[model samples]
Every structure is written in structure tokens, then in C-alpha cells.
Target: MLIHGLLAGSLALSGTPATTAQAKIDCAEVKCLALTFDDGPGKSTAKLLRILKKERAKATFFLTGKYVDQRPALAKRTLAEGHAIGNHTYSHFSLTPRLDDEIFDDIKAGQQAIKKATGLTATMFRPPFGHTDERVLRIADELDLAEVKWTGTTHDWALKDKKKIKAKVLSLAKRDGIILMHDTVPQTVQAMPEVIRELKKRGYHLVTVPQLYSGKLRSGVSYP
Candidate 1:
């Protein structure tokens, strides 16, 4: 599966197995997973945060500059509440075929804005559309950032079905995995509480991305 290859090549350096390996980690002491929501700072973003707090969980939010411009306070709120903020580029128009300099500029612009609003500098970048090539990786390396991606998604932005959202999350979830759900969709926010509940029932600890990878605070970017 695409996720298996992606996780093997990108996240783990020491041959960690795929999502099916969750059982061992799930039973491990202090089991953890990274929950990342992207392309956000939308109206639903705050609601998503509320659900996360009720679950007593945290997540990383990759916020686009366009959304930040529209909802600057929401972006600040994300940081204020201790969720890591990441740059999702300014326009999020497209990263494909763009030169390295252009992509870096876009990411930096996003970084500057978020820093301005929240006194936080984001060290994670999600290339638009999950489109990453050698150039994208190089730019992330140059900027001292990590390229963040996801293992499974409900495609909630496309489908509004809450049942499908919860099912997809549970179906593909794994310990220490980065699960992608978007903050722009109400259905996603609606589905997250149950998702967290199920993960808790199954003995998974939801962690920030940096914690998932490095056992550190979510200040810098990281993979898991």
C-alpha cells in the first residue's frame, strides 16, 4: 500500500512495520500516535480543538496563509491552546512543478505570518496536495523543516459522511502513525471525538507529531 511505502521510506529509519504493527505498540507503555489536521484555521478549526480538548488530546495543525489571513485569531488560538502550528504554504495553490525557490518562499511567507500572529515559528511544511518531489524535500531540508504527511484519511473534505469519517480513521489508524483529517470539514470535527474514544479504548495514546517521532514538545517538525 502507498502508506506502507511512505512510512517505511519517510518516517522510520529503523524498519518499523506498517499499520498492522499497531497491536504491539498499542499495548506498549505510553502508546502514542500523531494526529495532524491540514489546510485549516477555518470556522470548524476551533470546534475541532474543542473536541480534542474533551478527549484530552493534542494535534498539529498545518495552516495555510490564506486561511490565516481570513481567520488570524483562529490561528493564534491554535497556538495559544498548545497545538503545534505548521506552514501549509501561502496560497496552497500548487507546489507541483514549482521551482525550489518559489516553494520555499511560499512556505517562508506562511511561517512569517504565523510567527507574527502567534510568536511561533512553524518548522513543518506540507507540500500542497501532498505533492513532494526531490525539490520539495530539498527545500524542507534547506529550511530546517520536516516534510509532514499522513497515513490515512477519510477524505472528509470530499465526503461529508460522518460514519465514513470515523470508519476510515479507525480502519487505517496505527500506533505512532500520522492520521490526516482536515479541519475545514464539519464532518471531520464531528467524527473526531468517537475516533479518539475508540483509540483510547484500544489503548492508543494520541500525541502531537513531534512526540510521536521524537518524544519532544511540538516545537519543531518531525515524522513518525
Candidate 2:
């Protein structure tokens, strides 16, 4: 995949070794759950990354271009730590309402921002607020991004309470599920330690979105 190739290139540019001792888990044979956080590389994201690292869990982060420009180091560390990154649009705009050229420009700007920040081109995208349509998907496809939607969302952006966020995540947990969250939310970051531990206890392998699909994602396709 283009993203995989970009990952390798980024690693080389950063002087990080591409090979890792981490053993690969085949999701097809195990209960795998993808924990995806969007709209970030925010202040709270560093804490979230620490929690994930302590739990030895890998996740996928959909980064907004504006935030990437603000926290380039955080974005680089995210990919370097073995988590996957995806474009979440340049300005976090709702692509569904925009004109076709505007949609293309926004998504393209996002791709450019990510590339500049981390030297990696993202092949996955999640529309802000989950607002998308066929046209949005087509525009993303032109940028070589697959549309990644969630099986369930914690709605942590609204809840804004750590306990409630944790509870919502537990309730929505499932095998091969892509769970939506926001790393920009402080309460959600606070809730992650407990959430990661509990999900592990439930025997689900916390993995990146691409790992959930075994890295066979196609551009323009919406995922499970």
C-alpha cells in the first residue's frame, strides 16, 4: 500500500530502523479491535501515547492538518512508535457540504500537511464528524485515501467525563471493531489507561485500523 511505502520512507528519513521485534498478530485468527482517535496530535495526545505504550497497544490516529502543523514532533512520534496515522482533513471541515473543488483542496491540503510534518503520505482518511457522502469518498480516493468509519463511537467529545467515556468504550467494545474517539478530548485521554486495560482483559487485541484489515485496505472503500 502507498501508506506502507511512505512509512518505510519516513523511517529512513528519521533514522529509525524499519524492522521491529514486535511480533505480528494475525487479526483473522484472533479477536482484534481497532482503537481509532481523531482530530488530534493535541496536547492530550502525548498522554494518550504514553498510556498506549505502557499497555503495549497500537492504535490509529486520524490527524487534522492544522494540528499536525502545530505539533509536528507529536505527529512524528506517533508514527515512530508504531501506531498508524491518517488524514482527518486540513481544517476539520465537513466535506459533505463543500463544493467538489473545495473538498478536493481540503483533502489535498491535509495530505500535504501530513507529508510535510512526518515525511509520510497518509492513505487513510476519516471525514470530520463522520459527515461524508459518495462525492466525499471519491475525492478522498483521488488522494489515495480509504474512508475509515467506526463500528461504534464513544462520543467522548460530548460526554467529556472520564468515567463516562470509559464506560461508553467498554459498552461498545467488539471483535474486529473500529472504535471512534478523540485524542483532543482531555477526559478521553484520561479514560484511556483503564479502557486499554479492560479491553485487554476482555481478550481483544488492541491494534491499528490497518491491522484490523490486515493492511489490505483499498482506496475509496469504506471500512468495517
Give the poorly placed runs of model 1, Cα more than 4 Å off: 1-28, 215-224
Per-residue error for 29 in candidate 2, Å, reads 0.4
Q: Which stretches of candidate 2 lie over 4 Å from their true place?
A: 1-23
The 10 consecutive residues of candidate 2 with the worst lDDT sum are 11-20
lDDT of 1 by residue, 104-221 (tens): 8988888778877776766677777788777777777777677777877668788888998889888887766788878888888898888888887786766556546552323233
Evaluated at residue 167, the lDDT of candidate 1 is 90
Which candidate has the top score in lDDT?
A: 2
Q: Model 2 compared with the native: what TM-score?
A: 0.91
lDDT of 1: 0.70
